[model samples]
Target: MTINAGRHFVTIDESAAGERLDRALAAALPALTRSRVKALIEGRRVALAGGQTIEEPSRKVKTGERFEVDIPEPEPAEPVPQALALDILYEDGDLLVLNKPAGMVVHPAPGNPDSTLVNALLAHCGNSLSGIGGVRRPGIVHRLDKDTSGVMVVAKNDRTHVALSKLFAAHDLTRIYQALVWGAPKADRGRVEAAIGRHPVDRKRMAVRKSSGRNAITDYWIEKRFGPPLHPIASLVGARLGTGRTHQVRVHLAHLGCPVVGDPVYGRKSRNAKAPAALVDFARQALHAAVLEFRHPTTGEEMRFATELPQDFSKLVQSLNSVK
Candidate 1:
């Protein structure tokens, strides 16, 4: 049988004989699902070897018969692209790294249907994004919270996406964050090892629980202490994640009795009230993904990136320093 561009040809073997056309095609084309195969057949894009179109998804297949399926290009993403400015750090054919600013949602959700990082990426990458993640999250392998600002990487194709996902699952990548907390730790460095799950009463928040939830761990060190020597009001800390769970860093920090400053959900109101007015005025969590390290998916080269604090965070730190 002759092969052509944008078409896949498969010959039915004895093992596939007498099976429904959709089922047979699904086995032949592992990349396409049964539903997708049915859609193709219904679209009249599947034909027998002799050019006889097969529109019936349930038609029985015969042994030794060959069929061809015309593969369609992926459709445009559903999210509308806006001319949003992006802080791109690096880019190539396989992937891109960007500094995601605070207040930008990663993807569209119930309340946020546009102006997300996904929508911006759709416009930035255009048709180059990997469709494996579907239309809503094209090329997205992981996410950062809307209020957290820092470095993030995005895949441009399926191979890179799968590779990055595996790396994240194995915890083989490096993600380091810097945060300002309300109080200094008794010890300069320590680790928080706990299980994290959705809060029982508050579905939107994560809590440290022993009986339920995924194991989460964070290693942190005090970078600097602010305020009077005997009564330090705040501390700047660096945290490294061992397990990436929802709100893992914030939950672990709060569990350690040093909730991040400006974290409305996990921070204590009394502690926030004691902070300098400039620091208290900060709206979002005082956390930034300062460093990211990983190996290139295709080249195996070690890649590392770091970002400076945003203006708001820098100014807040300055305010704390002045009041110290």
Candidate 2:
């Protein structure tokens, strides 16, 4: 059972031409149970563009229509206890700031119903959680990618929840990150002004588009650069974020012709050195949410918190340093 499960969007293809909606998904994702697919379809969780729910799994899906399937993580063998180690950066009666580690799931789902940050908070906070999210699980104001380790904040009561949610929506909350990219940008520091929306072709990924999307922006600076001297190239570099969107840092860096190191989707083998065995061994993208700052939900006092880079990301930079 996966401790964390990521939601992936799939677009219907010509090969899936005239197949039943559920059948197509079940075929594409053989790992998903037919019953689960059936449940999702019957419950109208499958949606078409414009966010209308689609039922009738057997309904022949039309090409070019996007569909989202919430892939639940497999349930754990035993419930993960509430005692997992959590790095609490700051805390008050109304809210708590946590430095979430990489690989920790934020909440529960079909396959991953236990051992998540929610389960831990249920144990840790115990009866203090705000119910305003109303069965959306814990009061999660925002989220970090499962592999993206960094700081996050949670509210403890209803009033606090509203305030915190507004802060995120208004972009008043200060969110910053550090990332190691595959190559260096032309400018040391610059703003990436791009509109982001689901990919036109690959719905599973988000891309910067010329038209039709939300305003997405990212600002970055080169912390370091690396590559072999003999066949020199800037193989590694670091960056920060000015805005947060799904895969924003990865997409922005990729758009600049420098995807994050070890990023499977954005960084292809050709633009990067596949010949170097050491480079290929790199794991997930090298990125970390380094700081988050905002005012206290109830008290109205300003608060700021920070987290150190996790070991995997730290070691990756060290490896890059060794090459030069």
Which candidate tops TM-score?
Answer: 1
lDDT of 2 at 40: 75
Please state every model's RMSD to the true fold in angstroms. Answer: 13.7, 7.5
Which portions of model 2 show Cα errors greater than 4 Å? 1-81, 228-240, 270-278
Q: Give TM-scores for every candidate, taking all chains together and pairing residue i with residue i.
A: 0.75, 0.72
- How far does residue 263 in candidate 2 sit from its true spot (Å)? 2.5
lDDT of 1 by residue, 157-176 (tens): 99999999999999999999
- Candidate models: Cα lDDT each: 0.86, 0.72
Candidate 1 global TM-score: 0.75
lDDT of 2 by residue, 1-324 (tens): 222355556688888879988888877667676787888777544656445446688889777767776554454443333777888887777888899988887876565677788778777887888777655456777877667799999888888899999888888878888877655787878889897766655545778877555678887777766765444344444445556677888898899987776677777543544334555666776678898888886667788887778988787667666564
